[model samples]
Target chain A: MTNVSAELDSRFRAAAAEEGLLDVAYDVVDSPLGELFVGISDRGLCVISYEADPDAQVERLARGFGSRVLRSTRPVDPARRQLDEYFEGKRKRFDLDVDLRLARDFGRTVLEELGRVPFGEVTTYGELAARAGKPRAARAVGTIMNRNPVPIVLPCHRVVGANGSLVGYAGGLERKHQLLRLEGALLA
Target chain B: MEPVRIPPFETFYEEHKDPVFAHLRRLLGQGAEDAFQETFLRALRAYPELRNGRHLRAWVFTIATRVAIDETRRRRPMASPWLHELAVEDGLPPHAELGHLTDNLPPKERAAVVLRYGFDLPYDEIAAALGSSEDAARQATSSGVRRLRERSKRS
Candidate 1:
């Protein structure tokens, strides 16, 4: 094994990396925006990504699972199953246990508020923060989203800037634009 | 005043159901379905004392953990079938790998590690739940992590 792999493996095991393996046993899928990274955990469905950077993905996984990831043969896996239904517009509510471990206080509050944004609709950061009972925390909410533990799963793309300005997204503005278009939120 | 009976047991079950079920599911894995039913059965027997909702979730977890441990001990010397399934699903070799990490650790250490990983609990909460000093809880997690790394390295 490569030295980096060995080091990564050892660090992961030291994190007591069980339980999450089942959750991370997932497969990527082709989406309108780009390749999607969806993984599950024993607690429930976890990360749904749109980026291609392995390091960022690994760091997110490690924060939740220490370093454990699993693969499954069934292409129609739990994570994929629910997510496919979500994008197909068949499922509105998610039945997954989200791991918001990397989020805290304001970040956590922001994500929780995002969950209430409702499907097939969009909301601005200031509106979301107001719902979180901290209207001035809008900018803080935007910063919180820069490191959202579960991006697409938490629907960070659904958040727009004031007056519907397509704001910055860790997964790139293109994917954000595509997602907004897919949800029919982008204006003519 | 004679202790007044609460409404139907369903009320308590309805209140604490999901969190209790989720807790047991993490603790015992797939075996939680059965253990959950057993927990409520035992709870029914002691319904009067379960009135306090302040720690209801933790209380349910404690009882469920005890029951799971008992069932686990009762079936010792034989690989736990449920654990075997979990190991296989997690991509670990079956047979000897089922409890390779867990069976070797002490119960407190195992519970501490399980709670920490399963629920993402911090050291202090784990110590409180396991009735140990914060230092002891941290030690248990540290040692447990070390042993897991060592065993996985050999594999």
Candidate 2:
């Protein structure tokens, strides 16, 4: 069996990108938290999950986007850079374009509002719900945070409970705490 | 009933890329690289809609065969009348390289012979790859082998 040479593999990726056949391009980047599986579509950066099984992450991307997902780092380079800056506390706000296609309707709305919560600020879930134009949807907003597809980019970690306690982070509350502390929203 | 689990395209591509490349190399030789890229690009474009993973090997091979045929026809617009005559009567030239010999066969026969002998795919799978009935695939393989054997005898 002839092994695919790196040159040929890169050529295939370039051709696929030119033909618009690469629907989702992803890469794994090292971060202060851990390895992040970053997935980007032509629209923008879409998935930013804490490292788990790489195969499982790719499968989820295939299910959400088209199955034309590939491991091309160039498409994800900007996100990686920004994430690195954020973890190092050198960047105050993410200037990167985020693809929220994985989240929809109210979840999309809440996440969008969450992005504007600033780098060193914290907001209650009820405040986020009100900003999303549904004050009664605080519980629903919490659920959306639990399923935030692009968490760090969307600032899901800045959200807290009404009692000012860290709660309902899908990546675990400890990660949420660490993120908040990194942004100086919580004391280190 | 449990739903069929279609593997991610990455997994699917990894599993089939080398074999598909080998099949295309047999059929298209130097042009296999381009045809191999086309086959996988086409596969990736249609991967999300695929509901069944059971026939993925056949599916990819089918794509590779079509790509090879298209590449061949593009290069030689009109089929060479002499090649057809040789296939029907005296067989291909004995000294011809295996790639050149197979390249001169009719598209279906070339695909059948490559899929069956080169890859050792079962006849039913060959039928799927060639998009023909199993009996037809069997007949094509036998005919293709006979032509190659006849050429060998003449040498």
Candidate 3:
């Protein structure tokens, strides 16, 4: 689905925050996968890490967003609700604004191609590599997916081994299988 | 001067809520909650202008003072005509202890005491917030403290 939300209008921002001039705000949200650390930049959702270490993630966010980050749920509630809906099989698409500044050059290009891989479908790393305009950079595509800042929402789990088998997943293969099974992409 | 980076509104709230809330609570008596909320809303609207990031705590308290005064102005006229609008205040009792301590002071003097002693705001900042000379701010606080002591001795 198309990304949703433009500028958070003054009215919404005013109610959502006290200062309303933060560089970024983040909070830990409950997911089917456990607690997910979500960060929303002033622009949009910028970081969603599979890594659950909030301190490290906060450090990284400070480095990226310059320590203007605080834990506020208002900006992140929409993203969290959509994720909940997805895991419950009620949503096939994420209609949320995403800021991809962290992903860059080859990695960013790879994620854009990964978005086209679609829901309830699977594709090969080598295939996605070619789609990213690198005929032989299958391993590089793997690296890109591995480092994906925004994972499940971006459908990184949809990429598999060339043998058409589920391969590595940052969230672990079990979660990957769980997602694929939920999506009905895998058959028992 | 190099621009000081401002944190997210959430973070700022976490760091500053206690002092700001306490300051507003003492000033507005029954309307403290409304004043507290409005102060932050006004601060949110003015955030971009504070990107320079000098004395943010004092700046916020300054905003809270303005909000408290504005709340007083709002409540004065509607006190009798619209009693139902005052229902929320009925639910949450004004902090009777602190309210009694400074209840006799005028709004400006109450603000001066709350800012100076309650929040430890400096004269210059308090004056800026009250739109008066620093000496006037000090006088207000002195007058406020003197009245509070007289009320305490008589009781």
Candidate 4:
């Protein structure tokens, strides 16, 4: 039997993309914080998970987006490059488009505000809630931060406790501290 | 019994793609590439709703067979008789020897024979793939085999 051709594989992917069936294309990239599972949709970059289990991450993406998630580097290459630059301190702001479909309502609003916090700056959850037009929803904002899908790109680590203590990062406090220090937001 | 966990679509695709392609190649020959893509596309579209991954191989083969049937039906009206005659005179293409033998069979019979003999799938699985009774699947396979035997004898 003849081996399956590489040409056919790419053609299928193109056809799937054209039909909007290739909902998410993902790849893993090495970082100072270990491997980052980066996922992108045609809409934009959607998921940057710090989860250890790759299978669970893919399953979550399949459930959130459609099940047409494929392991291809092409769609995620730009985000990976930007992340590499950010880690190396060569870039401050992300130029790539982000897909925040995974976060909805107030959570989405909070993340949108978080994106504007800039490099090396920190905001309290209460302040972020006010920025999102809900001064009394600070604890709710904390819940949103704990569930932030696109973490580092949206800079969820920059949100600290009310007393300026490092707190409440889904990727863990150590990684958050490292991220803040990397951005010169925290004095090491 | 434990419930079967459906794997991620990527894992499912990697496991079944080559076998499904080989099955389509035996039935559709050069047209297998298109059918292969169609099979996976359909599979991916419906993958999340699948509650059971126990028969995923058979499930994909069913999609491949239906795609092959559609492709053959689409091509029959446009295919020239002389083109087929010339192909016969020139001998069958290397990757398509089985395809040539089964080309004249009814689509379901061709699929039945291929699934039964080539892939060693049971009559029940073949029935499921062909959407027929298991007895009918067995008859289709035997009749397809007999027809191929007579054709080879005459040649």
User: Could you tell me the lDDT of residue B20 within candidate 4?
Assistant: 80
What candidate 4 gets wrong by more than 4 Å, as runs, is A1-15, B1-8, B24-38, B45-56, B66-110, B113-136, B142-155
Which regions of candidate 1 are displaced past 4 Å?
A1-23, A53-56, A73-76, B1-155
Error of 2 at B116 (Å): 8.8
Best-fitting candidate, scored by DockQ: 2
Docking class of 1: incorrect
Q: What C-alpha lDDT, on a 0 to 100 scale, does residue A166 get in candidate 2? A: 89
Task: Estimate the TM-score for candidate 1.
Answer: 0.46
Please give, for residues B16-95, the per-residue lDDT of candidate 2 as tens digits: 88888877776667868889889988887888778877778878888887777678667765552224434444454533
Candidate 1, B4-106: lDDT as tens digits: 3343333344455566666565555655656665675566546545444455545556666667665554556355444544344344454444344676777
- What DockQ does candidate 3 score? 0.13
A best-first ranking of the candidates according to their TM-score comes to 2, 4, 3, 1
DockQ of each candidate's interface versus the true one? Answer: 0.02, 0.50, 0.13, 0.43
The RMSD of every model to the true structure, in order and in angstroms, is 18.5, 5.7, 11.0, 6.6
Show pairs that collide, candidate 3. Answer: A22-B8, A68-B7, A68-B8
What's the lDDT for all of these models? 0.62, 0.79, 0.72, 0.80
Q: Looking at model 1 chain B, which ten-residue stretch has the lowest summed lDDT?
A: B3-12
Docking class of 3: incorrect
Model 1 clash pairs are: A23-A40, A23-A41
Model 4, position B150, has a per-residue lDDT of 69
Q: Rank candidates, lDDT, best first.
A: 4, 2, 3, 1
TM-score of chain B of 1: 0.48
